[model samples]
Target: MKTYNVAILGATGAVGQEMMNVLAERDFPLNKLRLLASKRSVGKTYQYKDQVIACEEATPDSFEGMDIVLGAVENDIAEQLLPHAVKAGAVVIDNSSAYRLDDNVPLVVPEVNPQDIQKNNGIIANPNCSTIIALVAINKLHEYATVNSIIASTYQAVSGAGVPGLNELNTQVTQVMNDEKVEPQVFPYQIAFNLIPQIGGFDEMGYSSEEMKMQNEGRKILHHPELNVTCTCVRVPVMRSHSESLTLFFDKEIDVEKAKELLANADGVKLVDDPNNKQYPMPLDTSDQDLVYVGRIRKDLTQNNNKSLTLWCCGDQVRKGAATNAVQIAIEYIKQNA
Candidate 1:
């Protein structure tokens, strides 16, 4: 078996750490695993399998002799560092939105568009966490019947914002329980016992940056440029998974039973649609795993035709959405080009 040298940028952060876990869990073929982060985090130790690897400060020279570099940093840092990794002869699978829409880079969701991986020009961008969970749940349906449009409402977890978001939610909930004043820092307002309708800065048309990602990234991943999406993203107090209510309009007739049949055999999806018994997808059941749980499948009540269907889905944003997706891209890359 051939093994490759891999490096993880932003190794101390939530997604970065999860990338390591996924790499270990999947038992990726590796000759060496390097953990790279800021100077402040240098010497931080992480366990991969039975080996304890210490974090090293990421520099231009960090990608020396590396075959793959998984990026889990913010856009600015990704913009600054990832290109250098590419220059050093490493193919980068980036989780940041920095290069997602770039014409030269491929935005990939492995199950939805693994073919696009071969088209990458040294970089592949992972779709937004919410975009990933939604698309994974719907890709099979789209393939069976061409999806013309999507109306989605996302209930995002605070963990989507990273470790700070998680910490802020924890602190605020505690403060509220103790009858203390809540101070909002990571979020615009208190996220404990509240829902914030805004996930990113609003556009002139009133759609937020996060809401627009569903349309833009979805189009790129599904290769359906004409696909329309109207999305509303909300930040909820859930600790891990993100849940979404999706109403899909297809080009051809697709009944509820057919949608359920397609999703039952779909990759990366678990069907839990026994609504009569009060079974449906929820954040608590879907958290801490890679599969996207989909349920509540039914016909759209407002739409008269069979072309419209409504369903709900939940997935762990931190795992399948960010870390596992990037790792999957790397795995696919190795399988194709190894």
Candidate 2:
């Protein structure tokens, strides 16, 4: 087996660290591994298997001879550094919203659109984590019947906000438990024992930036520009895994039994729809894994037609939503070009 040189941008952060873990866990073929981060993280060291790899300050020159670079940074840093990495002869699978909707960049969900990898112009953007999880859960249904619109509400985990989100939640819970005043930092308000209906800043249309991604990114990834999505994203107190309640409107009728059969065989999805036994998809059950657990499959009671159905799905936001998806894109990219 031949190995390629791989570098992880933003190695000190949560998703960045998970990228390293995914690469290691999957036993990806790599001749070398490089960790890059901000100047303050330059001297930090991260363990990769039995090796201790030190972090390097990311610069245009840092990606000297790498084959692939997995991005796990913010939009600003990605804009500044990724173009140079591409110019330096490396294909980048970026996790930021930076280039997702760029007509030039390809937004990919491996299970849904692996062929789109071929259209990349040196960069393949991973779809929003919630978008990725939602698409994967219902992709087979889309294939069975033409999906026209989606109405979704996401119960996203604190892990979606990275390390700071976790820290803020933990600190607030501790403070509030002791009857002390809680301070909001990473989140706009107290996230412990409460839910925040907003994830990103509100748009003029009253939708948060995160809420809009479901429509915009989903349309791009599915290659269905006509697909319409109305979404509300909430920040829940869970430490990992995001759960979504989705009502899909299809052009054709799809019963609950058939939907279960389709999803049971779907890649990256696990069917756990036994409501009688109390077996349903939950954050605790879906956390630390790649598969999106989908359950509570049933027809929409209010629709009065077979064209619509409702389901719930859960997936580790950090893994499948971020690191794993990018790595899978890199894998598919390698196979097509190799």
Candidate 3:
């Protein structure tokens, strides 16, 4: 078996750490695993299988001799650093939105568009966490019915905002329980037992930056230039998985049972639909895992024809949305080049 040298940029962060775990969990063919982060995170130790690797400061030449570089940093840092990885001859699979829409970079969801991986010009962009989860749940259906448009409302977890978001939610819950005043820091308002309707800065059209990602990123990944999406991204108090309500309009009528059957056999998706049994996808059940749980499949009540359907989905944004998806792309890239 051939092994590759892999480096993880932003290794000390949640998603970066999860990338290490996923590599080990998936037992990727690794000759060496390097953890790279900012200077402040240098020397931080992380467990990967039987080895404890210490973090190193990421420099311009850090990616030299690396076969794969998984990026889990913010957009600014990604913009500044990832190109160097590419320049150093590493196939960079980035989780940030920095290069997603770039003409040369392939935005990929392995199950939805694995073919796109081979088209990358040294960089492959992982779609937004919400976009990844939604697409994984619906891609099979889309292949069958040819989805035309989507109306989606996302209930994103605090973890989507990273460790700080998780800490803020925890601190606020404690304060509220003790009858103390709630102070907001990571979020615009208290996220404890509450929902924030906004996930990112508002656009001129009132859509948030996060909301627009669904429409824009979705179009690119699905390769459906005409696909329309109206999305509302909300920050919920849930600790891990992000859940979404998706109403899909397809070019042709799709039967609910057939949809369920397809999803039951779909890659990266788990069918949890059984309405009478009160069984469906939930964040609690989907957390800490990679599969996107999809359920509550039904015909759209507002649609006169059977061309529309509604469903619910949940997935661990930190994993499938960010870390695991990047690793999956790397896996596909390896296969394509092997």
Candidate 2 residue pairs in backbone clash: none
lDDT of 3 at 86: 91
Model 1 CA deviation exceeding 4 Å by range? none
Q: lDDT by residue for model 2 over 69-179, one digit each (tens)?
A: 999999999999999999999999999999999998999999999999899889999999999999999999999998899999999999999999988889999998999
RMSD to native for every prediction? 0.7, 0.8, 0.8
The Cα error of candidate 2 at residue 234, in Å, is 0.7
lDDT of 1 by residue, 84-132 (tens): 9999999999999999999889999889999999999899999999999
Give residue 301's error in model 3 in angstroms. Answer: 1.0
Instruction: Estimate candidate 1's alpha-carbon lDDT, on a 0 to 1 scale.
Output: 0.94
Note the Cα lDDT for every prediction shown.
0.94, 0.94, 0.94
lDDT of 3 by residue, 29-128 (tens): 9999999999998898988999999999998889999999999999999999999999999999999899999989999999999999988899999999
Off by over 4 Å in 2: none
lDDT of 3: 0.94
